[model samples]
Target chain A: MGNTKKNDRRDFLSKFGTAFIAGAALSPLISNASELLETENNVTEIKNFKGSFEDLLGGDYTNIKLRMQDDVRRALKKPMKDRKWAMAIDLRKCVGCNACTVACIAENALPPGVVYRPVIKEEIGTYPNVSKINLPKPCMQCDEPPCVDVCPVEATWKREDGIVVIDYEACIGCRYCMTACPYEHRMFDFGEKYSDGLPLVANYDKRPSFEYGKEWDREDRHSSPIGNVRKCTFCAHRLDEGLLPQCLTTCIGGANYFGDLNDEDSVIAKLVSRLNVFRLKEEMGTEPNVYYIR
Target chain B: MKKIFYILWGIAFILGCIGVAQRFMYGHELANYGNRVVWGLWVAMYIYFIGLSAGAFLLSSLVYVFKIKMFEKVGKLALITALVTLLCALLSIWFDLGHMWRAYEVITRPNLPHSMMAWMIWLYSAYFLLLVLETLYAFRIESGKYDGDKLKSYQKKLGILATIGIPLAIAFHGGVGALFGVVAANPMWHSALTPIFFLVGAIASGSALFTLIFAFFWDNKKGEYYQNMLKTLAKIVLVAVLFDVLLEWAELSIALWMGSPEHTAGFRAMLFGQYWYVFWIFHLLFGVVIPVWILATKKNGIAIGWASLLVAFTFIGVRLNIVVPGLIGEKIPGEASAYIQPRLTYNYFPSMMEWLVGIFIVAFGIGLFYLGNKYFKLTKENNSVKS
Candidate 1:
């Protein structure tokens, strides 16, 4: 249903854009005809009246008409906000299954030796009286992001809807962002591929944004120049279609919660208020958007 | 003479090309680096070369601004060295950048308020311009054709410019050091003294590089002016080395006294862990200690020249110690600090392509230097007033 709405919007934008251009091209002809009509009526005094030429034309001057139409088109084409995308990981409910990590790899079709998410195991106390804890780690998506600061080319930036994004095309693989990230979230695109299971999958053709919406394309995936850095974008492709992140959806123990903190009424926000939520490296003042409830 | 130089240049060019090819093909995996040790030899080399440039430029200021007759013979050479080393430093960073093409965008659309890297871009560009203008002025004076009126006016203008440049040179290198030091998350590098340490190291290494290069150029022909220039430069090098050592000791002692586990871990990594040999043996013993001893004890001209060579080589080691050890440990282990040993066992052997490109840059710098010297008559005879 959401896809149909988006398609309708896209269609409206395409037609509007075409009409705006056509209107701009025909404005002079319309003005000339109006002038001819005025001359035929012997209305020479109309030319001397002091008002904008646009007002004189009395219909629509092409530039302003096109501009208004373009604005409408842009508004229609703006990305939908149905999925106020969020993630919740309940540490108390988690088991050390490592299922989410495996799921993320499978879903993302990650390159060999690259794991987008990893489960970290920590043991506390002496050997005899020790308790083990499993923590699933993903990109923190910090509010005051350090990675964005040190990106020399401004390739990585924060989106208005509160997600950090990597413009892979613009990133010059300097990895300064990797160095700056205290969370150790960023990864270098070494142009590695997984060719073992399905050799042809390694050669999967990449489609443009219109086709696959920045998911996976053989030509465009890591082809963003090898030296550029990359990190998780909270599954923007899935989020666009009102779906939860793969890790969040596939968690075996249901440990993660994803939602909008901005909405006071959101379930995640209510849960966060009730539980003692924490973020990693809070002392660094990065103010990560991801919250953890122990 | 030109043929021999060209042949040597060609060889260096071929080797650098191979190194670059390997770097591109293997994705810096060929270099001795990993997640834990993200920075390695290239970063060290970058800092080292920048330090050398700053040092040489500072020394040139002595001749140009302070009117130091004893160091006049090598002023133009120092300027040329400054230019070349800066180029080399820039190239090192270029190869280090994962996305080399988007480097320009760093300038066009810079992130302000919180970006140290952005500041570095602006600072480096300004510093490069200052060096170019100062060097041009130095060349003009090196030409004997400078009439009395022009000579006085040029010196006055250059002296004023050099005064401003000295602080800028200090800041450029110090700023680079602070780039790493300001990252509070990196317990190894975050320090108030990091900028000061960088400045001292730049001066020390710069002096060492100049002493070595000056001696080599001097060997081509002997002159009283050249001898005096060497003695003065040797003295400057001695002072710089002592200050550098003192700062290093102070920095290390403070780190030990603070006794933070992470800080201690970083220091120990340098003193005894993976980087011990490079830090203790090459950086301390060869770079600082032996050179200090040689400079103090050596009386013969030949001995001093050899000491200068040792100093130059050891300074390279010092740069490695500064860059590598700080980046070897992890704030968060296992997850954060992935093992990043260079694919090649020795950690680094710049592939043939890398060497070829590196040497080509060097050759270009040398060619410029030679032209500057030949056309401008950059000899002490050209520097004198008839009165």
Candidate 2:
């Protein structure tokens, strides 16, 4: 029985080879037919899903997180002066899911009353004809930050990479910076807790946030950040590690985009070129790094 | 009457101690001022007291620099009041700081040319020293420490000191106004008129307070000299009140006329929002209307004293109006409803703790004033040194 089966397979292969050669010599259509037939035969060897390997290798994947991660890695290769980090948010793609806000809270270990990002919802027109817009606000990180100049202690400043950062240690928590910020992005850490009324505070609740590449324990009442004016840093710690910002990665609808604006080939640079792009309170002359695509 | 005042002081002092304990333990957790309205009752109180100090000191210049004899008896009292109020203003603001210990940073490592607050700090320090020196010089003459030629020389020294103090006082108080005025983000405070208005308000409030103190506590109130002093003080306050009202009207009418919502929002809020009564009731009714009526209608020291007291006490409402309205709105069109977190909203009213702390600072100032008045021989009649 084994000898007969081997002879039968050899006969089938010889016939298939003759047909494949004839199809390739005949026309493009026939050549495509032969290729599809061969692919079908290759699929028979797998007992599960077809085209899984081609789907991986075929370059059809368009995951924003992966694209942004690659963009960040490329950005890391450039010097700080050459890397103008910026963010572009597409309002049309935003579903107001607030995933970015939650992700930021988790990534920064933000306490209650201290939010780095908030999605503002507004209803346009009247009742039946109304439409809604969700605007997610973060720190503008202005080029000419009013908050920077108004700081009596020089606790906060603009970085070379265009991110406005606060030195929690030096901040007097006067909230003058808070008042100076037209966007009202700076928040005072009122030393509140998310687990205030709980039976016992969880260990995760006490986890120190690693902001500016330094671990900060909030348990000590006399510590720095507790009395400091706090705001978003655009996930600077993660960027230092060649990773995308938590908000960008956790964006549910891929509405948030971040990359080096200095890079001519970056996604943010491309989006910012569009006519629909704008910044909040542009008249105030803050010259914000964050842009929006309506 | 003295017993009643002492009783009131004791009650407030005890209540203030409780608030102080809460403040140290909780650290602004009990205060109603949030991230949006970062300043509240204490901040308003600071500017109020500072204005009072500036006004009183400026009025004292009338006696020292201008050599106005009608105001001579109250010059020492005004100086002492200025010092006491200045200390209270500093204390109120100090407690408002998140890290009260780091206040020295503003002095030690300040962004000098950039921050109005830094300039205010330096100017106030100079003003403080000048005030102490001026008070000592005036006390030297009043206490009969020097005779004839020496006395005249000490008076000359006071005149010189007061001359220097006039500009310093204006700079420091105007610096306070400029502190808020420099913030271009808040359109209500960004006006060039803000500092000018503060100077006028300080004069009005300070002169009103000086009038009250002189009328009620000047030791000799039944004489022709007393009546003349009271008459002159009332006239100064009346002129100041009228000038302050004119400036306030100009500020409001111009802003309202501009038709820009950003410019008018704060003014409108002051006039018609939830706390409209703060402007119309507390400030206009008690601070302006009643005082204006009494000063205009009556000519007696007792009437002017009570009316001046009303204006001086109710000016806190005016200060609050200046502060809260500038901060009580959304930056963006819908920013007010954007977030639902504690202190992230526009609605702000001082919590009980804030009120207690504010009351405590005032009570503390009153106690200091009482002690200073009783023991320092600050009054004209008590100017003699103990043998």
Candidate 3:
């Protein structure tokens, strides 16, 4: 018992020592990381200095993120019916990196067979004339959604705030809506995991996802989301939490924009009006809320 | 021959049980159908079997509604076939659902006025109830088994039920077609002609199945009466097939001649793609030419029996053509390649497990019919002279 007490004390002391060294080592990187990705890539402005430097040379758009955050904070104060969620993607800025796709997968805890957003790539020409285009497709959240009309059970519906939401508990997974959606955005969850054949399911695969603001643990194979069809919700949970979507947070291009279209002053609304923007399959009359600024 | 057939059935049933077990344990993972080509063999089979049920029930209408004396003996047998096949259709579609248990939601929280599938379910429910009533009345008032007022009451009830069922079957089966037709996204299935074609195909396939069942299984002596019945049933089958074939030709020709890639993609793929034999050989040669030739040439029981069987079985390939091709090529090109995974495939053929499960539905349907026959005596229970 005396030996155990000594060992425990030593272990505690060592842990403290390691944490102090690690914190000291990471302090500089942490401060730098906060300012590292804040500016637009081309920012070259000289500004009044706050630090010891003669002048601030760049980072003109460093506070742009804060401004967007403030916009979201203000929007969240309004009633649900008064808010209309929408997205604007600048196609010229997208480099086809697919960081947004990866981040979305992480955020949703998507299994192997299910995906909400995938970056669609196309190479336009041959050899020296080659140019590539990337289109990141998510659920359109149409005002007149064909998917909503095709479901035998009323498992999916558009929210008052304009996000299309599926009740995983109510979805029978018939996949009728999948066929009806011209964009083919809805994906069926075939109850697969990343570690399907392995002895232990991957750690992240077991993580609970907060979708539709509900805690969904995918440990049970015969559970709600497993046997149900799923789609993008525009990261409504994060919107409710006054934060940007994981896709928007991770997009290296600064191409993805999300805000309320109902608020004319919102970023998405401004982008839609300022640029040559259009929704996919406008002839289908789905009234898609997502717009692409080409 | 009978012993050999029973042994083969036993083997198939055992294999089917393994498939059913696999489906329950692993879910859709063991199945080949994925997100892109969402419907597969089972969906084809669901429509095929449901078509057969609708056809068989409609064939019974000749006896009960139209009061045709020639088709007097076919009513009960047709009803039994209808019931059994309908049960199989329900089973096949239920199994296709990701959450089979939640299928009750179609009834509980249905989205009607917008969903053709919801309309289909409601119509099917009504049809199922009417069918049960009609079958009960038919059974209770069997031939040479009812008295004066009892006979009239049973016949009157049966007549009323059949009258309701005719329109019910058309609406439900047409609604099934409309279910595909209404999906304006898929240009191939969006045509207004789809529901009409489905109705006629159901009659063609369903009546043919009933005729085949009657030819071999009915416990009637191979006399003048039997030969007359076979001739009449075969003629009905032949006419229905001709009508269905005509409609099919119109669709193929129009789609091919006015070849927009989007509209003609499914048809071109059906005719010339990898699984061309499904359309050319299975559907055309076996389903149409051979059956039509045999049926037109002779009216013998043996000849009509084989011809009807060919038409009934090969119609499955036709149903497959309807489902798979519509969803085949990239509706949006490169969208399939946009995300790479096993289930995100654009091309599909049924896996072995799928075929095995199909066999199970058929075997289960036959088993139920056998029990229904033994208990209810839908057809006369007597010995048959094998050729």
Pick by TM-score: which candidate is best? 3
lDDT of 3 by residue, A1-294 (tens): 122234553343234333333443454676753354333321221122122111111223343344455567778899999888888787765767788888899898888867888888888888756656789988889999999988999999999989899999899988899889989888888878888889988888888888989999988877878878899998889988999878887665566888878776666666676547888989899999999977
Cα lDDT tens digits for candidate 3, B22-96 = 888878877888888888999999999999999999998988899887776668889889999999999999989
Best by DockQ: 3
What is the per-residue lDDT of model 2 for residues B7-28, given as tens digits with 9 covering 90 to 100?
9999999999999989988887
| Tens digits of per-residue lDDT for model 2, A247-291 | 886665556888888877667776788788999989999999989
Sorted on lDDT, best first, the list reads 2, 3, 1
* DockQ of predicted candidate 3: 0.54
Q: Relative to the unseen true structure, what is the C-alpha lDDT of residue A249 in candidate 2, on a scale of 0 to 100? A: 68
Least accurate stretch of 10 residues (summed lDDT) in model 3 chain A?
A: A48-57
Q: Rate residue A195 of model 2 by lDDT.
A: 83
The DockQ scores of all candidates, in the order shown, are 0.21, 0.50, 0.54
